[model samples]
Target chain A: MPQRYAYLGPQGTFTEAAMRSFPGADEAEHLPYATVPAALDALRRAEVDLAVVALENSVEGSVPTTLDELATGEPLQIVGEAHLPVSFALLVRPGTDLGDIKTVASHPHAQPQCRRWLAENVPHAEWRAATSNAEAAQHVADGHYDAALAGSFAAARYGLSVLAEDIHDVADAVTRFIALRRPGTPPPPTGTDRTTVVAFIGEDHPGALLEILTEFSMRGINLTLIQSRPTGAGLGSYLFWIELEGHVDDARVGEALMGLRRVCADVRFVGSYPRADQVRPEIRRGTHDQDFTEAAAWLASVRSGHA
Target chain B: MPQRYAYLGPQGTFTEAAMRSFPGADEAEHLPYATVPAALDALRRAEVDLAVVALENSVEGSVPTTLDELATGEPLQIVGEAHLPVSFALLVRPGTDLGDIKTVASHPHAQPQCRRWLAENVPHAEWRAATSNAEAAQHVADGHYDAALAGSFAAARYGLSVLAEDIHDVADAVTRFIALRRPGTPPPPTGTDRTTVVAFIGEDHPGALLEILTEFSMRGINLTLIQSRPTGAGLGSYLFWIELEGHVDDARVGEALMGLRRVCADVRFVGSYPRADQVRPEIRRGTHDQDFTEAAAWLASVRSGHA
Candidate 1:
């Protein structure tokens, strides 16, 4: 089958890396788009079968465009999700040394991750933003910059040498990207999963928003994230993005979603996918109960309303 | 006295023009920051006595960064606001003509506004995203593109001649910018105006969001726009921005806000001012009635529960 997945870019982007993380990724053609809306438009027109868009990065909170696109009533439905361990590094032309770098170029998303490293190494150098890490790497390759902040994949793709690996200030540098498809073409389940949905309303008057939320709380549904984006209608109302535990097709979840739809103007089920275990079995061999206990505690807080 | 304002760029951004709309503007020193967080940090650190940030543009909706910054736990208070008219035009190098342009470069916000113009005139051309309109103009000057979508102010500043004026599709394009400060130094009421506040959480577990909104309904607080940004904690939680009919200091508004704070986790007043009577008074006369009518209708909706 000729599979097409639309992603934000001019060919190479971190989202493309995330798309490649899909199970049956080999031989899939990638469609590059200038904006998320354009990608979704292509999906609606059936030009692409799927879209891989970045939702949130641990360091950057949420991609408002992704949230907004989901809330804007797209005919596309989210089918699967993947979380890629985003590891950023400083890349430069093949023969360039760290000391030879006068300027560093990168996407804004990369700048924050490499903040500490950039400050310590090139404190006074000017930082410029290119369209993507791949573009930044290309700029470095074209001799526009002595160095660039980019992902490992981008460096390899552009044939640049990594001057430093894993320079992100935070050890937990991860980004969650989602796949979208037309309704009824859902990705097969992988169990231990989660689903995302969004709703829009004008007067979430006092209890309106919560009334919808209670449908999940009463059912013991584990909600992961809730966010809102302005509807651009000039009224102080919103379109909300919400994530909850279990697939939307699950009996309890199905009932909850039905109840939510009745209360919200527009409600959409984005997707259901196996929640990513950032650390694979091989990587978690020795760190067994250490982080797991912390994760459980955080989940408990969320369940108890403290979160 | 050193008054400071923050805009979204290293220098020469449209936000700078909006920031200049503040009263006693000559006393304000422009502080350029790469991101909104940097500016908010300056406000939090007392490094700047006041900060002006762009809240939203009529064509592009609310700026997520500004909304995200407002929702942060901070003492910053909104005390005043201004609506600046936005006029996007196509600019080119001294010798470049309309037909010679193979690409249109602009910030993403300008892209949608100029979509019609681009499609009609530069149909097959590529659209490149620049860091800012000023940067786009600079790139055009640097021969990166034959033309760029820029504001009149940017064209003047960069010495790029305007090839087309008022090319944005929206005739009423305006951006609402707000002035913020630490709690103790709220901007004095210029009188005969309005105020902005953000509220979150609700009284009852079910329909909590709706319950809090009731205060505005009962008190006739006209909400101009309400958007929710992620608190980044868990699902079904958010921070809401609400624009109302009167200043928070007004007795009725004061009572409503006080009541709301008791029911909500936070009821923050961002700022308020007399709504600008005209965005482009000289160019377009007497179109303010449409906005006022819309605002009045929204206010009635809040009161009647139809919104």
Candidate 2:
């Protein structure tokens, strides 16, 4: 039996595009779930070998729900990430003209990216939300909606025509997607790897957030993203979704995680995987693995009362 | 002549209270400005010796407008800060009862804090915005509004009766206010001083923010607050308002600033003022000032072939 790959889809979506970008995805059995939670849940229930979900989009920004789900739920390890430059296309039935469009359907996130074009072209159109842009295209194909804002590639899959291509107010929008599997030892350090962790600030620790950032900073790790969200535990406690440069196996990164574990109320190691951009960390002097190892040795000698 | 102190006030407001907390406020001439910008501009124009404005609040969070004003405009140096516990009160005409109130007034920020209380007590009342809570009380005294949510102390100043006091949904809400003056020598290092700076990310630098945090982190300096705001320069460029634990004169902090200045496109030193809470940073073992000094000396010795 081939490995199963689950994604948020109805045949064609940005998520499916992201999933296909992965190695051996064509050889793997493709399973489409109606929702992101459904896809991840299937993976959690051992129904799928792996799950792919959108983590951050340049235009819509970070998906808070996805981050929260990954950070708080039963552990899943991120094996890798993929970046796709996103551009929307208006999909409609072949006979439908821009003037004939009365209602535009798309995922809530996709609609705003083309709101201006829609206003000028389809002045009479009202926006309808769908779980995925592919689902919107599916609806358009079934005569449930006049048009949809989706990827142009989705048009052929849904038997729809590209009414308008490259429909976006902002150019060069990119979405970063992550692939996850059952918690396991992460992929080996690639020198350009990225490690992720969620730090729950301890109660009554006023500067706990600073302490969390300091752990990575002191190790010369560059935190690519820091999204602070309420822990849902109390009156204003926070949990940070921190993504940083370096693999979990790196000496400095291991030390940083240990430091975070020591300070934060709870530190959850998500995983370490190769960065999609493959940009290597700019390791500062005295923060390299050898530096940390030497520093540890120096401390041990000092503790042993050696000069 | 007494030193002139400009504050965002019409008198008897929270800002006035914050301004009065200063050392020579009572001895100095108090000048009330119509708006926060007006108050700071007065200081900039050399019309006042100093200015005080709200920086952050536990209830409303950081005052973005005030922060942006100080960060982007002509530079002002913070010399002091005060944290005042905020609670609102309902003020009305002397003969009026709680039931007589039809419309309530308060600053927009203050109104939300007391929204639940107002809904429970004055369910029929409508909320009106005021420049300041004291102005709301003055409006109540002038019969412009049926009731005003303000500081209880404002009742005595505006000749209004307090119908209810300590009105807030959340308890222990504190607003932090900063005192500013023309750029000059900063106050000598207090062990618990806080340094503020604004760092503009360079045009092409990807992880400039991480580099900024690393500078502080590598020096064992704790960043008490990190507020990222758009530079308004372009579609995605950002500027960060970073407040960290240490004085400008501290060897570690100076080094951190120097490191930041080297990496960031531009680094603006807002000020180094005594922290309102006076919380000293936890200096890690190898990051203390003497450690940095010793490391520099060792590096120099090794470079000169003396190691």
Candidate 3:
């Protein structure tokens, strides 16, 4: 039996494209969800063996819904990752001219990505928000709107004509997607891997964050992203979402996690998985594991009175 | 002559409510801009002396557009701030029943804040996005929609009756608004103050961020928020937005700023202003200035051979 894989969709979404790019995704039964939470819920309910969702957009940073969902409830671990270069195309129904466009629709995230292009080309068009880019294209195809800003895949799937291609304000926009599964052993360290964790401070005090960073810094782990989201307890309380360059299975990485668990009020290990981007040679330069091994050996010798 | 102030609005939006709460707002000529960038642009063009924009919400975190606008272009300094507790009311035409509601409209931010209430009360209603909460109320008053989720102030302004009150999922939701003006001397330290800065890393090397945090950690500064946003330079590059507990006028804060400037590729001082929330006594317990002064005095005595 084919494994069931869920993605954020009405089909033709950038998320579906990301799901397709995942290894072995072709052998899985594709399921479409109306929202991020819905898809993650399906995975939680065991309706799907795996779920894929867009975690971060290079242009927009992290997706808040996905981040919040991952942070709460029974733990979900990212098992794999994928990157899709994003390019929006203006989709219109057959024979709809630029002059006939009164309202342009797309997901709120997509709207701002093409702000400059829309302002320059369709200055008078009113903006409408959709649940997803593919839904926007569907609306246009269903004659609810004059045009939509969506991916080329969405235009093709929805049977719409592309009035404009590569409409994003930034030329090289990319979005990173992650494959998630029930908390389990993370994929084995692939030499070039990334670990994500959320650290909640014990108290709102000076140097609390410093203590957390010391674990990673002393171990020579480079952080790729650090974001603070309110803990919802009140103002000034936050949970730091941190992504660093190392796999949890690595000795140094394991040590850092152990140290963080000791200091943090709570620590949620999101995942340690192979990174989607091509590994830069610089990321693999140092082996903090070797340093840890040597230091442990020296400490043991000193403890045994060997000077 | 009265000064002119611009805020995100047509009028009666939560932003206007925040602006009204500012000191001397009644004496100033208030102008409403359709969006955050529009209001900031008005201030930039000298059409308004100051712009009041919502910077972050306790529930949603930072408003990316406001952060991005402040990050780019001619330097803008946050001179003051205000906090408004957010609560939404279901507004409808006088005689409309809850069951008669077919579509609910509000700004995108407002919709999510009341998600639980909407899901439980009107689960089948379609969601519509409006430019502002006030505009949503206006739509309902004009019979375009059956109801709107907006502040009670908007309900009164738009002549709609509240069908439900305090409908936000979280009762304590609060938004932090900042008053921005052209690059200028920040308000003098108020004993209880906050400093916001953006630090751009000099390079993407391991431990780069650790070095940046050291300046604050060594100075005993407490960071309130730390977020990383893409620098628009492409993948893997980011600018760190940091909020710490100290005024720029403080000796320790000045030292940290100097240290950051030396270590970071660039440092933008967003502002040092009084915090809207009450200051915790613990934040005032230690003055790093005294520490710096004592260290300097001790070093001088040793260097002069007086020890």
What ranking emerges by lDDT with the best candidate at the front? 2, 3, 1
DockQ of 1: 0.01
Q: Give model 3's DockQ, 2 decimals.
A: 0.01
iRMS per model in Å: 19.1, 16.5, 22.1
Residue pairs whose backbone atoms clash in candidate 3: none
Question: List-wise, what DockQ does each model earn?
Answer: 0.01, 0.02, 0.01
Number of backbone collisions per candidate, in order? 19, 0, 0
- Across residues B1-307, which tens digit of lDDT does each residue of candidate 3 receive? 8999999997879899999988889999999999888888888889999899999999999999988888765677898899888788899999888899999999999988999899999989999999998899999989899999888888778888999988888878899999998777777778789988888864688877877787676556788888888878777777889998878778667756655655567777888889888584243323356644654453333223242
Chain B TM-score, candidates in order: 0.83, 0.96, 0.95
Which digits, one per residue and each the tens of the lDDT, describe model 2 over residues A25-76? 9999999998788899999999999999999998888998689889888878
Using TM-score as the yardstick, the better of models 2 and 3 is 2
Which number leads on lDDT?
A: 2
Clashing pairs in 2: none
Off by over 4 Å in 3: A1-307, B281-287
Determine which window of 10 residues in candidate 2 chain A has minimal summed lDDT: A298-307
In order, what is each prediction's RMSD in angstroms? Answer: 31.3, 22.1, 31.3
**Which tens-of-lDDT digit does each residue in A70-150 have in candidate 1?**
777555667677887667788887878767888999888888888887899878778999978778889988888878887
